[model samples]
Target: MNIGATVVFSVLFLLVTVLGFVAAGWRRGNLDELAEWGLGGRQFGTIVTWFLLGGDLFTAFTVVAIPALAFGAGAVGMFAIPFCIITFPFIFIVFPRLWRVAKQRGYVTVADFVHARYRSKTLALAIAVTGILALMPYIALQLVGLEVAIGALGFDTSGLTGDMPLAVAFAILAAYTYKSGLRAPAMIAIVKDILIYVTVIAAAIIIPGQLGGFEHIFAAIPASKRLLRPPTASGLADYGAYVSIALGSAVATVLYPHAATALLSSKSGNTVRRNMVLLPIYTLLLGFITLLGYMAVAANVRGMPEFAKYFAAYGNNFAVPALFLHFFPSWLAGLAFAAIGIGALVPAAIMSIAAANLYTRNVHLAIVNPRMTALDETRVSKLVAVFVKIGAIAIIFGLPVSYATDLQLLGGIWIIQTLPTVVFGLFGRTFDPRALLIGLFSGLACGTWMVAQQHFKTSVYTLHFDGYAIPLYAAMWALLLNMIVAGALSVPAWMRGAASFTGLSGSGDSLRDEA
Candidate 1:
């Protein structure tokens, strides 16, 4: 870590800290209730919402992981680019209706809407727990990315024999977040996004020229190493896997609670529509970043133990910074490093907020004390926000990089399983509450078992399925099973006078006969 880089990062850190405090005033009035504190007073306009959500979506994990995948395995990382690009259209189509219904019914979290519609606290709670459980590991992964970036570019790895550095960084992030709420992250995002775009876009242009070009870099790899695992020899990645990952990721992307919160925090349906159109340009930037991996390989930046090691000697988070430092002036490299570092802060803060909200509303308020007041919810949420930050710090310390990345992917699969309820319940007429529960459980089980089966390397859950290697990413498949079961159950349910879920008279809240 050079003094130039250190000073650059430090100055940006101070700037973000100031932004956090000032953003607290962005709301229309004082943020007294939990909703305002947690959701930016439900009044974020086009600008704040665009930057805030972008800051959240273009996360640290994406920064490190995407290029690593491409560098580690060619052509595969492109999946992330398309997946991100395609997701906005999906969001535009589905979430506007979701937002409309939520606004009409005054719903906050997706679980709130699910519970009211399905009339099943059990089902809603299951979905909520999956989301929070899945998200914590993802948040932890972001810390890992930040650690890599800092160690590579800023921190001297000597004398730091443990997780102490990561723990300290997370404590700082948590402290500011607790003081100011979502407003802190939103303000910081403005700077974070700007720095990231400048750095990544600059790298995309400069690195290729430094390494001759993409064709030259890719030509260095041996033909055999490009093939898949033993018992079969194919391209390192197949078309099926590529398409599956891309499509699956696109669908799964919008289903994430944090992602949804980012979308809902927007000002209006039109804002979401407009943002969706412009969001793909970021995907083009990601595609550029993914090329850095091959560029590193061609630049002879690899063949070292643990990709991060090779990325070090200068900076471990080198997908972007390495390229910048390699080809640009020293001061410009330092500026690029600063942007990625600041980028970590913005989303890490929001993720910490989203996790805290889940714990407060879905788990704590629902289970511990159903009768809690608005002020009580606010207090409880702040406390939980503090603890979630602590948990994120712990994750940074405790988990391995490889394991952490796997968990984040598994989180996507798990969170995506809740989609039918969220996407379907908005307008589906025959979907009875009881039927939805049975389907949800069945799908969840099937998906969990599937993920376990496929994740032979790092995951914990697995089951054999028709002579195929499958583990992790069962959320969609499991939910498909859940839907089938729910449909079957609804028939008998209807025959047996299961309380009609539709055509309610009075207030739309009085599903009294089910009692």
Candidate 2:
């Protein structure tokens, strides 16, 4: 083992653990209430909200994967840059409304809003199931990132023995998260964001200086790997997958329950928007990080036989970690590893809590126990959070890292199915709840089937129409089918009038008034 790096990493991780426990009382409130424990008493201001949501947005999977993608595939991997760019505009336009509606209705989860809007426990349950299912793999991706970082620390990474360190790390994360609730991640995110910025900035300056310059780095990358457009059999550039994947990811980014959990914890709608305006600063940082991929290429990291084999076997997920070990001193590399681990832990804690909140509100309380008290609800959420962490660890140890990548890709496609109902729902309830249900299910089913048919290799599939192969994203097609089904069915429902619908409990004005 790289003892210096490992020791530094342990100390940093231990400090974060201590912070997590103390954060239970950071913004102390009634721990018995789900609103307090699950959502930080809904009291986070601009700065805290910025760090929390920023840390949640730029996760370990992102830190590790973006450069890994660039290292492996060239420009296509940089889709993350545009993905982050487009996301803020979308969030700014959409999330304030969601925040308003959610705050108005005392909704704790997105599923809660679905229940209030549709008045159908079944529909809300569907949303809850999708969120939970998508999140498990999502959280598993974080663990995979953590594992990769740990391996970079020169530890043994073979079989169950390799997973021992990860299990211990997550156990600490789960314990503190259970004690401090959202505040745990909220507090640690500060440290996480700080470490990430410092590490990336250091890498940005140091790596290129060590590798010559940008010109040399760009020139060194192979031509085929330079752009995002993939080549067809005829060697023509195909942009379908690149465009679709970027768009789909942008749409799906905020749909995750954790994103909603972080957003709802803000003090107000304006606080949510203001934080978003500043959130793009991380996108710039992300742009710098993606360069590590090209840097990895220019530095000829693959020239090392073992590192080359590892890259070939596991994909580019390890590029950043490998680069850190290759360039930095042992201690600094350990700090990088700790940063990645903390980055993963913060989001992992948030996601587990969000999934648990969904279960507690939409499943446990809505179906299992309508009379469950606030204190009981908080307790159930905490327990469910621990259970969710266990499931994520199980996924990590059970699946190969490559499969974890596939699952996260599939997750983006799956979660986007909710956008039609949730995002469109914010504008107006013109679309009938029944139509929304049909659309959501149709989109979800079609998207999943299309993605599965591709064997999880790519997000886009081509259809032979007449003589030409028309390429499209599974998400795009699924979304099209969704809108068609929804639009077709909703007309009759709209003609029948929203008032005739039992689920139409209130108008937009009424919802806003409740705020």
Candidate 3:
């Protein structure tokens, strides 16, 4: 066991645990009110919101999985850099409007806005279900990241004994989150971001130097893995896959419940907009993080006997951890690992809370108990948050890490289907909720089938159009079908003079006007 690393990791982890609990008092609000507990009273300023959104979006999974993808698949993993860059402009434009409507209407989840806008409880329920379902694998991926960090410190992450450390860590996380709610993650995010920036910046400077240089790192990669494949007369399959993944992911990034939760916690629309401009700094960090994969390739860590078992066991997910362990001293390695593990807690906590908000507001309050009080809603959300984390833990134990990654891709596919309803619904009231619901289900079914055709192994599916073939993200294809169906159905309603059904004229100002 690496005693020095373990000790440092434990110490840093304990510090965060203490901070998580104390955060209940940091913002100082009534813990029993749903707004106070779930949305941090919508009071986070530019700096706090910046860290919260960063911690929420750039997760531990990104640290592990992106680099792992780079290590194994070459330049395709770099799709995340462009994906992130594309996301901020969307955020700068859309979320400020969303925040305005949600704030005015007291909407807690996207489902809440969908319900209020369309006045369809069933449609809102569908949105809630999709958000929760999409988040399950996402939260599980965070645990996978934490497990990798813990394993790097020489823990016996096998059988029952392996599950114990994860269980204990989550138990502490759940306790603090239940007591503090959004404030917990909002406060802890500051520290998590600091550690992540330090770790990434240090690695960017130190690792390449140790492994000869950037030139050597690039030279060491096999020719096949050096760049994306060029398009041919047969099709632009590779280019399509690359561009579609970037575009699809950018659209899907802020649609997750966790992302919504973080954005809604901001003090105002301006805060969300300011962060959008500043958040791309993280994209730069992601670029460095992706390079770790190439660094691992340059160092040939997978070929080393010491890391062979880790590669066999965790696959590419261990690339960053193994890279740190091989190059850095034990204390520094421990600090980096702690950054990853703590990174997991921040997002996992926020995601669980987000899912709970969806369930409590859109599902339980709307269906189970219409008369439920704010206190009752807060209580139920806190309890649901705990259960959500438990469900995520079950996923980690129940499925292999690769399955978790694949399921997260499927999550993106599933969540993006909500775009027409949530994002488009914000601009104007043209959609019939029934039509949107149908489009949502259609997209879900189509995307699932497409991914299933690949045996759940890849998210990109190729289409044959006569003699030409094009591969693209299944999510994008599904989203296209969703928009077409929703638009087609709406046109019929508009022609029939069923203005109410079409949401054509009077329902309240569009969210854009409110913004």
Candidate 4:
């Protein structure tokens, strides 16, 4: 290890670790309550909410994996930019309503909202189960990001021993998150986001100069690696997969429990609204990140004979780290590495908290003990957070890095099936709980099958109309069929007057007493 890099990384890691522990007391409240522990007492304001959501939504996956995809597959990887652009606007439209209902009903998880709306344990359980499954792989992607960063610093991450440092880092994260709950990530996000901004700005300026310039970087790339669309057999531009991936990801981004956790932690519906307006600035950082991939191509980081075999064994996930180490001095490179590592902690903590909340509310308390106290619920959530972290680490060891990335993608597909019940169900009263259940299961099955048929390589299917192939994302296709079947099934329920059932149609003040 370069001593300068190692020293800087060690100091930064220790500082964040201490901050995590201290966060438990930052906004002192009833720590034994689910609302306090799971949702930060639902009291974050505009800036805090902004940082929390920004840190939660933009993870090491955004910084590392998206660019790695760009590095490897060119334009298809840049799906993330449009994906993010579409997400905030969609969130703006749907989330404030979710915020109003959740605050009013004292709901701590998405399942809580579903249960309040439908009065069906079955429907709530389905959403709870899907959230947990989707979040685990997402948490694992954080580990993947951390591992890539550590490896970039010249650490040996080749086997189980190679993962010991990661194991220790996560253990510390679990400890603080269990102690501080959502507050740990909420506080750490500030530091992580600051480091991320500085690092990205520096890279955008410094890397282009090192590689001659933007034009030279583009010119240096091979034809196969430079196309904005999928290259045809004759090297033509076909953007079918690009458009599908972008739209599919946008629809799915906020469905993650952690993303919802951030929104719910806000002060009011207006806070969520203002955040939707301001969050797109984070997307600009991502443009720099995607550009780093092209710079990696220009620098020959992956193609260089000396480094080729190592990255080939590791997957192109190491592209950004390799580029930084090659071009920057040891100390600055260490800061970038630390940014990626600490960045993982923010989302990892929130995801575990969100997953734990689902289990405690929907599974444990709802199914196992309906009379469970707020303290009991908090206890269960804290313990489950540890197990969730363990599961994420297990995923890292159990799969190839490339395959782990695919699991994160599959998580999106699985979770997006809940949108009809969660997002659309907010506006109207047509969906019967039973119909929603059927639609969710149908979407899960069809979407999983489509993605699996492609051997998990892509999230799209080709539709032939008049001898022309129109590629559609599996999630969108599954959602269309889901809505069709659900609408058809719910018509009978609507005719039976099921739409008149009592649910969460309350106002902001409806929950003031509970608060």
Candidate 5:
């Protein structure tokens, strides 16, 4: 490990930590309010919203997983790039309506909106629990990426435990967030974007030259890697799994608690609308990162399909940094390492805060103590935010973990389950509350089973993606069944002219008044 580069990155990482604390002051006074700490006082303008959304979408998962895909599969990895394009139209058409309804009713979490829409706190609470459970692995994944990056930068990671680094990182994050609230991560996103662009563009330019250009590198990739495209020698075949994963990710991205956290924090519906347009460009950056995997191969940069394995070989999850270490000079690799390290912090901090808020608002305040004062809610939320950081730190000790391998399947399913509560409710549609609960149960069962079938191996059981041996992520299929069941059951009530379904509750304001 180069001592100079490691020293530079350590300094930069510390600087970011300090900057996080400063962000506490971005909006002064009364962070003790749940509305303020959890949602940045719901005051973020268009530019801040853009950065927050972009940062949330392009997380540590993108940093590690994209190149991991490219390293393992080749051209199939670009599915994420295209999926973003498809998802943009979905967000543009759907989210503005979501923002409008949420703003009108002062709804903070998706669960809040759902309960209002269908008059079922039970249904709303279930979705809330699933979201937090799903997001926790994701937050852990970011710390895994940071660990990889720091290790590769040549830090003395000899004594780091499975949970130690994550705990430290989370503690720092919790401090700033507790002090500054959502504004801390929101403010740091600017620096995060700057680092990402620098590393991505720098790697793109430098790596291709060292690799004998795209033409040379394309020839080297195996036929199995590209089901179609130029390099497949025998015939043109489509990479279905690659495409599915990409589209699945885009859909999953919107469903996350943090994605909603970022959106709900914005000051107006227009800000959310503007962000949908701007967020796609981050997908472009992701496209650039996916390409770096091929460049790494061209440079003979050693990286493994699994994040921990890759870190073992190269000591970091930063694909570009590893590539720089092998292909570029020592000094340049250090700078690239800085970008990757900074990149990890931006999204991880935001995600943990988002998850913390979910626990505090949707679960704690809503269920545990509904009559609690706003000041008390804020204090508990801040404290929970700290605990969330500490929890993340604990997970970090279990480093070299396959974050995507663990997270993608589960997170995808969890986020999609929110569609009914967040997306369907916006249009004033109510599925039968009982039916919705049944659908949620069915979806959870089917999705979890499908995922088990796709990947896990046991003496008695094995998961297979149909017959192909490829694991088709089950989130999409599970969600399909969930919505189908919800709708089909709902149709019965309309046809029978049931009294229960007729006087369906108005949005929460009316429902709360009734209660």
Candidate 6:
């Protein structure tokens, strides 16, 4: 192990661990209430919300996988830059209304809003279950990033002994999140974002300088690797896949329960809108981070004897870590690794809390115990948060990282199925609740089948029509099928003039009030 690097990493990790616990008292709220514990009393201002959402969305997965994708798949991996860019407009236009409704209704999760809008407990359950399932693999991906960071520090990460550090790290994460609730991740996110910005800025300046500038870095890459493949007469597979992933991902990004948790925690709808405008700064940071993959390719880190084993073991996931280790001193590398590690923790905490909130509000309370008190609900959520972390750790230990990636792909597909009921519902559209439920089922089943047909190797599926082949995101295809089914069935209900389907509480007035 590099002793100096390990010391720096340890110190930084220790500092955040302390900060996590201290955050319970930061805003001074009653921890026994679900609103206080789950949503930070809906009290976060624009800056805190910015940091929280930034840290929550731009996770360790972003640090490890974006560059890795660029390193392996070339220009196609740069889709994430556009993906981030596309998502914020959706946030700006759609989510502030959601925040207003959630704030007024005391809805803690997307399912809570779904329940009120549709007035169907079953539909709410479907949304809740989908959120939990989608988040499990996402939480596990954080560990994948953390594992790479820890291994980069020169620690063994193979067997039971190698897994102890991950366990210990998550144990601390679970404890603080259970104690401090959303505040833990919200407070730690400030530090996590600073570290990430520092690391990215330093890498931007230092790596290119060492590599003889961006011109030479691009020169080192083959033309095929530097640019996306053009569309051919037979198909637009590459172009379609790029556009579909970007659009599908943009829609799916805000739908994640954790994303909603961050949005609802903000003090006002304007806070969400303001943060949406400022969040693009991270997109610029992402562009810099994505270049690290090309930097790794230029430096030939995989060919280095010291890093060859890591490449063999972790595949492209090690590219960012390997790049840091090669060019920087042990101390600086440690700082970068800590940034990645803490990046994992912030998201992991938020994801667990979000999942827990869903289970407590939508599942446990709605189905299992309608009479559960607020204090009891808060206790259940806290306990569920710990169990959620434990379950995520189990995923990291029991399965291969590829499994987590595959599930996360499906997670996006699964979560986007709720868009009609959640996002469209915000517009005061009155769809038959049963039809919406069927649509949700259709999308989930169709999306899963398409992904399975690809053998879980990719999220894009190709359609062969006449002689031309068209490729698109499975989620988008499934969503189309869902809307078709729901829209068709909803026509009957609309024609009947059923007042029950009109809006929240069977009246369009509540929705129009916000309008």
Give the best candidate by lDDT. 6
By summed lDDT, the worst window of 10 consecutive residues in model 6 runs over: 498-507
Q: Give per-residue CA lDDT, model 3, range 96-123, as digits (tens).
A: 9999998998988889998888899999
Instruction: Estimate candidate 5's RMSD in Å.
Output: 5.3
Q: List the residue pairs that clash in candidate 3.
A: none
Q: In angstroms, how far off is 330's CA in candidate 6?
A: 1.4
Candidate 3 runs further than 4 Å off: 498-515
Better of 2 and 6 by TM-score: 6
Stretches off by above 4 angstroms in model 2 are: 230-236, 306-313, 498-515
lDDT by residue (tens digit), candidate 4, 1-515: 66777788889999999999999899898889989998999999999999998899899878888888888888777778898999999999988999998888788888988888888999999999999999999999899889878877777888778989999999999999988989989989998999899889999989999889999998987787676655455422357767877887887778889999989999999999999899999988888889888999899897677566558666778789888888888999989888999999999999999999999999999789999977898999999999999999898888777677688768988998999889877887669889899999999999889888989887877766665666778888888888998999989877666333333236455445434
Residue pairs in candidate 2 whose N, alpha carbon or C atoms collide under 3 angstroms: none
The positional error of residue 135 in candidate 3, measured at the CA in angstroms, is: 0.3
Give per-model TM-scores. Answer: 0.86, 0.94, 0.96, 0.93, 0.87, 0.96
Q: Write the per-residue lDDT of candidate 5 for residues 223-297, one digit (tens) a residue.
A: 667544431333222443455566667777787888888888988877877877787788778788888777766
Worst 10 residues of 4 by lDDT: 498-507
State each model's CA lDDT, in order: 0.70, 0.86, 0.91, 0.87, 0.70, 0.93
Question: For residues 1-515, what per-residue lDDT tens digits would candidate 2 score against the true structure?
Answer: 78999999999999999999999889889878899999998899999999998789899988988898789888888888888888888989988888888888788999998888778888889899889989999999999888888887777776888779999999999899988999999999999999999899889888888888789999998987886565565432467667777788888888999999999999899998898789989989999989999998898887777586556655678788878888888888888999999999999999999999999999999889999988999999999999999998888787776677788777877789888788877787767778878988999889888878989887787767555566777888888888899889999877676445433455766655544
Error of 3 at 472 (Å): 0.3
lDDT tens digits by residue: candidate 6, 54-84? 9999999999999999999899889998899
lDDT, candidate 3, equals 0.91
| Superior by TM-score: candidate 3 or candidate 4 | 3
